[model samples]
Target: MLIELRPGTSAEAAEEVAARAGAHEDVTAWPVRLAGRVFVVVSGDESLAHVPASPAVLARRPTPDGHWLVRRDSGVAPREVTIGPPLSGPPEAPRQVGVVGGPRLWWAAGPCALESTEDAVETALTVRAQGAHALRAGLSKTRSSPYHFPGRGLRGLEALAEIRRAAAIPVITEVCDPREVAAVAEVADCLQVDGRQLDNRPLLAELGAQRRPVLLMRGPRASLDDWLRAAEFVFTRGNSAVVLCAGATGTPQQPGFGAITALRARTELPVIFDPSHSTRSASLVAPAALAASAYGADGLLIESCTKPERLYRPGDAAHMFPPESLADLVATCERVRDSARSLEVSC
Candidate 1:
């Protein structure tokens, strides 16, 4: 059974209830600190009847599957727009692409930017061989510095199309301008809206009209409410295939997992974590990736390259994961996800 403590309930009050529940011989109380709730697994038939209840307990519900289904009122007013069906892939592979509604993890891997046709193709092949489900690259890169490489425009999209055809995998690419949406939608399997462009309504409207799945990156400085409102712009435009990509914010020492947790709790959209940008460190990617999976991310969008040292892009040294390292990270992430699933079931 899952129980939600009332809002503003003191920690001491919650702990008192937890202790009382834990004292029951057949009940094992597990406090979910993230959401400030408690899950009491009832093992004995008589204990269920003995459990205490009070006004402080907002909700108590049984979950036969051992998974808690939590729904809280976010207090954000609903937009005056139609919400389409839950976004999903084809009928056969229903949850492959859209926000995954299952335990299976989706993997997206490729170079941060499309270096060239040859480089993109080679990297795509390597990613596919190493168990990635999709390919991601920037067709028109967004950089903070004016001198940085600004991706291969139309040529990159052409290369991604060719790689998609050859590799038999879905291709995902970033689109920074409204003018480029139509062209990017033509070749890319999913269009990614960069974090910097979250408030660009014209571009969001253009993407919504394309009817293709979109990966909306959460702005580093934007609040959770702000991010979801941006998604609302896309959702209200008749396109429901929206995935939330949680980008890191704050200093390197304090990456934003709070926003990730809040987004997962507040919205039904599939959430994907970009550990490459989250930690901004190749060395920290593995640990962060594992943490994301354990924290219930539906998928991961990673930046990797065939040759990190040979790359000329800024942050290449800090963020690029080599093929071997990526492979290891993927394997470990899979294990962590499997373990998490097991724990969920055993609860």
Candidate 2:
């Protein structure tokens, strides 16, 4: 639950009310502002309970647009304040250990094999054309098969460095352990904590120590409460630049899961959805992307390959959409966001 303060409300008065509101059952309180209106966003069972239940401001209402705006009369006139559906903004400045590039539409790419510098450059070009703000790939893979090609490790990190150098886009890679965290930190712009490693508290702490933006994936089996606490492990270290990645649960849900819904409701960190790994069917990518956007996700971290058939990964081939398909999905996501914002005006 998010709260916004109205115009003319004193911060001190608002803070006092918020403190009282926070003490209500199951409520988590935070303050937000838009166009000079102060808001108190509440979560848990205590959200609407603390709002003035009087005849003037007690009722919940919606604007002509689809957004839910809190309507209350401040004695003189009725007032409405804006509260954003979840969104992500770039930090004021790149932290000492994070990506140099700014905030953007991120696309996680999977290049299963190590390729030449030229190949990486070409791939990065195609990715940029698709409007991806940043590119994600695997430098050190944690695969099920020990004899498999795995990842290029340092060599792949070098390739990613070259890709960033050539394309001038931020590059993200996976780090499996503390040593790899340091090693990957040396080359890539961000370090990812894979969903499988969700329980590895040690790695979470180590990544926090690096002070880079950590993309923590939600384990297919873990609860949302568990996921956020894991995120807090990093934040408690004073590293606030953390992001969440929602993938499919390993069960029949394959690509989408309750975890997606649960995490979106609970955490304020930016979350990116992984369609390729979560929904194994290519046909599901468009709808999944649409659903995630509608639910206020920070962004989509999809895998867009120029040619899915020619790729060297184990994910669903259909999910590895062509550039055109990916473009369509992105457009749809924009439409959903527009529709959500449209809800604001109708009120």
Candidate 3:
């Protein structure tokens, strides 16, 4: 492992960084310490760039304001590790399932409305209060008809930025256009690729260039291989924090085939399921969520509206379960997760 020191800093701190990076020789690691901040690099090769030849060599320098990612000749390359910690953070590897905010509930609420700026904040807060780890909003809505309502453009994105400001949990929104990737990167913590936009390879490539965590949703008609290959579009772009999402499919079955299981088995990337969209009904959301967990899905995303019928939206069937239903779903998911753990121990 290689360690670099900033211009004015002494070589003493580099030793500490090296020690931290090589703390576990079982896993190859690289850490750079400058001032009080530490930047880590994880790659397939053990050789790290230890000299400050250029400021551009730093892979990422994310600020509280905006990200400042520098371009370099050679940077942190991709590795097929099952788990790792954040680039610049504590040494411990993060747990597989990140709860909505706390506990082991890996749930995100997808509120499908962008009527007003106030509505965005209200909906996000509603989900966050109900133990949701993230707020999933759609900046670019894929409506059924050509005459249907789309998004509020760049103005709506500001609303999502505000929600992130007012809350502790992360805000996730979709970016359908390839051009919008840069703009969306400025605000949203995570970018979600809509099911319809899965076929748009260039857009996925552009999102990968931004080097942010992406939620790639499988298309309703797209096959499992098609979906995993789509993920490679991002992986090859040098972004490894890619997650697979099992969205609704166009199957004839009422609940649709268990595409979630097939997707999970196909890719090593963490898999999340959109139960709300899969069933398009509050009643079926629970069953779909259970199925996803049974098949080893990483998380669940359910559309939670304060009032589903009152919303000004065309996809009302997908929106179900007020705040109470979210709680119930969490409890049931916990039961299933515990059962799976027991089975693993017994075997």
Better of 1 and 3 by lDDT: 1
* Weakest lDDT window of 10 consecutive positions for candidate 2: 76-85
TM for candidate 2 is: 0.64
Candidate that beats the other on TM-score, 1 or 3, i.e. the better one:
1
Question: Model 2, range 94-159, lDDT digits (tens) per residue?
Answer: 122222112333444544343455655676667666666556666766776786556677767666
Query: In candidate 1, how many Å is residue 35 off?
Result: 28
lDDT of 1 by residue, 160-182 (tens): 77777676667789999899898
lDDT: which candidate is best?
A: 1
Candidate number with greatest TM-score:
1
Cα error of candidate 3 at position 105, Å: 4.1
Candidate 3: worst 10 consecutive residues by lDDT?
A: 65-74
**Alpha-carbon shift of residue 133 in model 3 (angstroms):** 0.7
| C-alpha lDDT of all candidate models, in order | 0.67, 0.57, 0.60
User: What's the candidate order when arranged by decreasing lDDT?
Assistant: 1, 3, 2
